[model samples]
Each structure stands twice: as C-alpha cells, then as structure tokens.
Target: MLPRRFNLHRPDRIEDAVALLAEHGDDASPYAGGTELLIAMKARVLSYAHIVDLKGIAALRGVSARSDGGLIIGALTTHHELANHSLVLERLPAYALLSANVANIRVRAAGTLGGNLCFAEPHADPPAMLCALNAELVLAGPGGERRMLLAEFILGELSTARATGEVLVRIEVPGLPAGTRAGYRAFGHLERPAVGVAAVALPLGKGFDWRLRVGSICGRPTALAGLEKAMRGLPEADALAVLAEGAEQAAAAVEADDDIRGSAEYKRHLVGVLARRAARAALGMEALAA
Candidate 1:
C-alpha cells in the first residue's frame, strides 16, 4: 500500500511537471503507469513524499512516423499499444514483436515503454534491441527538448542519464536501412532474463555488416564492437564460425556479475549460444514472424 501521508500533484503540462520536480528535488518523483516504481515503493525500497502524476499529460502518448522514416513513440505509450500498433508492425516488426512479449499480459497492460526505459532495469528487453537499432530518446527539460542516444540514456542498473528536472518525452527509432534485418534472443526463468543478445545485419555492396549487443549479464548493455569488426567482409560460412567464436570472446568483454540470476561464467556461455542464434535469425536463416 502507498504511504498514507504522501502528497500527489497531477500535472497536465510538461513544463509544470518539471517545475514541481525542480521544487521538490529528491522528494518528488514522476509517476507514469507505476508498474515498476509503485512496486518498489510498496516494498519499502524507495520513498517519495511527493508524487508528480504525469498521466494527465495528453501530449505524451501515441505513435507516428517521421518524415525520415523513423518511428516516434510517446512516453505514455503502453507496451500493449505499441505491441499491436499497425504501423509499428508494418515498419519495425522486430521491435513490434519484442514489445508484444515484454513480461506478461498484466505487466504489459500497466507498463509504459517510457517507464521501462526510464527505469533502466538491466534484465529487461528493450535496451539491447534499442542499442542495436541506434535508437534516440527525446528529453524535455527547463531549457526545452533535447535528443540523446538510447544507448547513452541508460547508464546502469536502475540508473539513467536523465536529469532530475527532465522527462523523457519520446523514443525515436531510425528507419531500417535497405536489405537490413534484425533479431533478438533472450533466455530467462521466472520472468527475468539471464542473457539477451541482439543482432542486426546489413548487406553492403559485396559483403555483410553486423551489429551485436549482449545485455542482462552486467549493469549495462555491451556492444560487440570487436566481433563486428572481425565479421566484416567475411563470407557466409566464415561469418557463422566467427560469430560463434566472437560470442565467446564477447563474454569476456562484458563485466558480468555473479548474482542470483547465475554465475558469471554460466551467463557468458549463454551469451555465446544466444549470439549465434541471434545472428542466424538476423541473417533470415531462422526467422520469426511478428
């Protein structure tokens, strides 16, 4: 149950919400769908005397296509909305499918993508995919709005680069390049992921280009830059072998911790296994329909 004496302020305007946050400082926290924040509060892990309810802000909802061919999702857009959106399914089926499978139906009903990303939970799904797609985040603050890479927005477990007085207003996913394919692989039990890998392959002239990221092993998602560099220009069979080997090496590159999820070494092995699978999926060898 929520604390009996805490104050609630409903702000329909972004500027007003930021002003309240500026006034209350650490005492104030923004409230979205509250799927994550409220649970933490009820567990006594976090306490805020002032809750700045942002659900009243009409501007922070919906999806639209940008002229650049990117997709803009509002901060208030729920997991359910995005998962089933026609345009999302049409343009970025990989992302649409990922959104569809986030947690359970109940959590998807109450959780907002903005909340998920803003919370920066390490074990969640969107971060790795966002990183591979080179997504951008739009933040609104006292100075107006600014854009940041989704990769930079998430700093660590339950941490983000968002300032106290700023709010993430939208997520921008760039248009997929011609002949580019994307895939994501994750393994978990009890609704918590142990390892998640994302792969994107682009056909460039006479060769293939790859982008890979390994997540849920450490505090932050890690890109496999070395592996991508090595895979460049390799033939089909050669690329598969290199991806497998690189997956093992990718494990070493991440600073995974030994926690209840699994041992560090065990998690590293999962990264390799999933990386190969994800690579195949990205290459359209083993594809899933949204």
Candidate 2:
C-alpha cells in the first residue's frame, strides 16, 4: 500500500523545522530517517498531511567527544554511522556493537536514532543501554531547548514526552568513572528483540556500582532497582552471586505481557538469563557458548 499523499517540507534549521511542526500542529511530523514513520504511513496506521524533513538540518548529525570524557551524539545520526564511528567505538564499544546489529544493514543505514526513540517501539534495543548509561535527551522547541533523562523522555510504548513542536536534537551520555565497564544482551525472533538487558559496572573500591536495565519485554525499559541495590556494595564474587540468584526474582517483578513474540513467562525467563549474562559481560567475564 502507498502512503497517503502528503506535502514534504525540508527545513535546514532546527527552529524552522519546529515552526513548521507548530504551524501544522497535529497534521505534520518531523521526519528524520523515515524507517518507522514511512512504514506506519504506508500501512495507513498513521497519516500526516505534512512531513517536515529534518535531514537538511546539519546541526543534527555527527558524533563528538565531550570535555567531561563523555559523548554527544546527534539524534539524526544513523545506526551504521554510529557502529563505525571512531569515537563511538573507542568510548562505548558495547553500544557500537549493538548499533551494528540493529535489524539488518539496510535499516542501520537509513534509520536515525532520533526516529527510533521518537517512534518508541517497545522491541527496540537502544533505549535499554541508553537508560543504563544515564543518557539524557536534548529537545528543541519554540520555547528553546530543554533537557531530560532518556528514561523520562519515553512515556510508554509508541509514546513519548515530546511536546507539540519539540524536536530531539542530541543525546548526551555521561562519562563513566575510571574502571567502569558496560555490556548489553538481547534475544529475540523476527528483527526485534523480545528481551534486552544492559548492565554497567563502576568500580567503588572493592565493591561496584551496578546499573541494570531490561527492555523489549514490557511497555518501556525497566530498571532492576532491587538487584542493583542488593549488588551495589558487595565484593566482586559476592555481587556476581547476588546477581545470578536474584535475576529471576527481579525480572518477575516487572510486568510482562503475552504477545506474538512469546508468553509473558518465557520473556521473564529470558530477562533473567540476559540480565545475568549482561552483568557478567560488564565484569569482563567471557561469554558462555549457547
């Protein structure tokens, strides 16, 4: 099926794009990589009379290092670019690996990070890791720019906190402390993950600061707060035991729904398995063969 007829407007500036969105109101959408939007439009699941193309806005592209030893990634950047970019590979190789495996090569080539988040598909991968890394989103609007934690930006499945005319400009990942390591694990069928987990381990003397996030099995990414609290101050070996033992209980606390992907029980099981694997990977342990 063909997308309903629409007028495409290319705006070179962020303000201009916001203006177009504001002017059209609900009739328009800010277009980046059209991967998700185009699919919905083509299926007639969504219809927009005006499409505000943001690709012409040069400010929304590229990967650069931050003075704080973190990263600033343009929202409009493609997954393929991120996977191969030097700074991304050097600073957050786990993220780079995740980007490299998103869907297929074609989607990675054309899909933009901003689009993926704005679309807010529950089965997507980036949100989990971004949340674990404590990433923040910078949004541009007629009122000027406002920033929020990425975890707060996503309201639920297929929904977000973006206002009427706000445009997501960039994603900010804070620097990890020395000796910090991060890892991500996801399992699924079709092209999307059924359950994805991201783990970050920051050394705190002999103990560790553990951040864990589980995604795709629920409406939005869920932090394993219970497990994190239990493992936070434990020695390396003890922490691993806590994580391995508590993973299933922690996963069961999150509400998983039955879907075409799998039964809620199965997804919860996957969550536990992946969470333990991700935490181990973050601790520089070897991956166990399937």
Candidate 3:
C-alpha cells in the first residue's frame, strides 16, 4: 500500500495541472501511470508530500497524425496503446516493436510514454529509439511551451532537461522518407536477455543519410553521429568497419554505469556488439529499399 499521509490532486485541465505544479513546485511530483514513481517511493528513493496526477487531464492523452505527415503522441498515452496503434505501426514500425517489448504485458499496460522518458533510466528503451527517429519533446511551463530535441531532453542518467513547474506534454516525430528502414536489437544478461543492451538504427537514403542511435548501455541514450559520419561515402563492408570504429568512439565518450545487470566494461562491449548488429540490420534494410 502507498503512504497514507501524502495528498493527491487530480487536475482536469492542462492549465490547472501547470498551476498546481507551479504552486507546489518541488514538493509535488506529477504522476503519470505511477509505475516508476510508486516503485521509487516504495523503495524510499523518491519522496513527495503531494502527488499531481495527470490522468484526469484529457489533453495529455492520445495519438494522432499531424498535418505535416508527422505523429504527435500525448504524454499520458500508455505503452500498450502505442504498441497497438495502427497509425504508429504504419508510420513508426520500429518504435512500435520496441514499445511492444518493454517489460511485459502488465508493465506495458501501466507505463506511459512520457513517464518512461521522464524517468530517463539508462536501461530504458524508448529514449534511444526516439533519438534514433530524431524525435522532439514539447514542454509546457509557466513561461509557455518550448520544444527541444530528444537528445537535449535526455541529458544524463536519471536526469532530464525538465525544470521545476514544467510538464512534458508531447513528442513529435517527423515522417521518414520512402527508403527509410529502422530496427531495434539488444542482448540482455544471462538471466534476463530480454532487457539487455538495446540499440536502434534508422536508414534514411543510400549513402550518407543513414542514422543510428543506441541506448540502455550508456549513461544516456545517444545518437551515433560519429558512426554515421564514418559510414558515409563507404560501401557496405567499409560502412560496417566504420560503424564498429564509431561504436568504440561512442563507448569511450560516455561512462557506462555498472550495476546488478553487468560491469561497465561488459556493458560497453555489449553496446559495441549490438551497435554492429543494428548497423548491419539497417544496411540490410537499405539494400531492400534499393
């Protein structure tokens, strides 16, 4: 059971939610699906006197296609809903696949996309995938709404660009071109291979336009730009070699934390391997597109 002393406030509108957050400020935590927040509270890792529940706010839920052929996903949209959405499956198939694999049915049923992104856990899957697709975050605060790229939004381990009195309202992902193909792959621990090092790759055009992002191995999910640059103007074999080199460089650039899952070095190596595999899959998609 949850603590009895904490107060819960359910706001019906976005303005009210923002007002409550501004009023309570640091003392109040915005509750989405309550999957991570409740668990953290139970473990004593996070404490808040008041909980601002976002569920009643209808503005923060749903998925719809934008006028520009992109997709806008509200903060309260659950993982299960995302995984099953026909528009998401048609427009962003790789993300749908990744969403379907997060934890299991129960967790997926309770977890919200914005909540997952807000948590910014290194092992989490969505941020990396979002980064791969070049997703944008829309935040609303007292100062008004502002947008930031996915990479900027997720700064480091368990940290985000979200400031006090700000709410992450939605994520906007632009549509990919006709030749684009993206894929997500990972290797988990011996006991839990399902949750291991997750990597995502997006192939744009044939030569230099391919993009890649890898997550769940480093402190923050990162775009593999250096690797993508190295692969540019190269043939498939050369691109693969460049990708491996870029993975090494990326591993060196970030400090992968060691935990119950594996050691730092082990995680780095896992990222490297998964990066290569993801790169190869992306190349295969490119070939099919060609």
List TM-scores for all candidates, in order. Answer: 0.95, 0.98, 0.88
Q: lDDT of each structure?
A: 0.85, 0.91, 0.75
Candidate 2 lDDT, tens digit per residue, 132-159?
A: 9999999999899999999999989999
lDDT of 2: 0.91
Q: Estimate, for each residue in 1-290, the C-alpha lDDT of model 3 and write its tens digit.
A: 45435789999988788888899889888999888899888877788888999999898999999877779999999999998999998887767877887777888998999999998876777877788777899999988999999889888878999998888899999876665656667667532232233333334345446566667766676666676666765666777777766676666655666778888777777767777776666556432111
Ranking by TM-score: 2, 1, 3
Q: Answer with 1 or 2, whichever has the higher TM-score.
A: 2
- Local accuracy of candidate 1 as per-residue lDDT tens digits, 1-290: 75535799999998999899878988988899998888888877888999998899988989999887779999989989988998888877777878888898988988999999999889988889888989999999878899999998889998899998788899988887787778888887758688888888778655578888888887778988888888887776788888876678777767888888888888888888888888888777777432
Error of model 3, residue 166, in angstroms: 1.3
Deviation (Å) of 40 in candidate 2: 0.3
**TM-score attained by model 3:** 0.88
lDDT of 3: 0.75
What lDDT would candidate 1 get against the real structure? Answer: 0.85
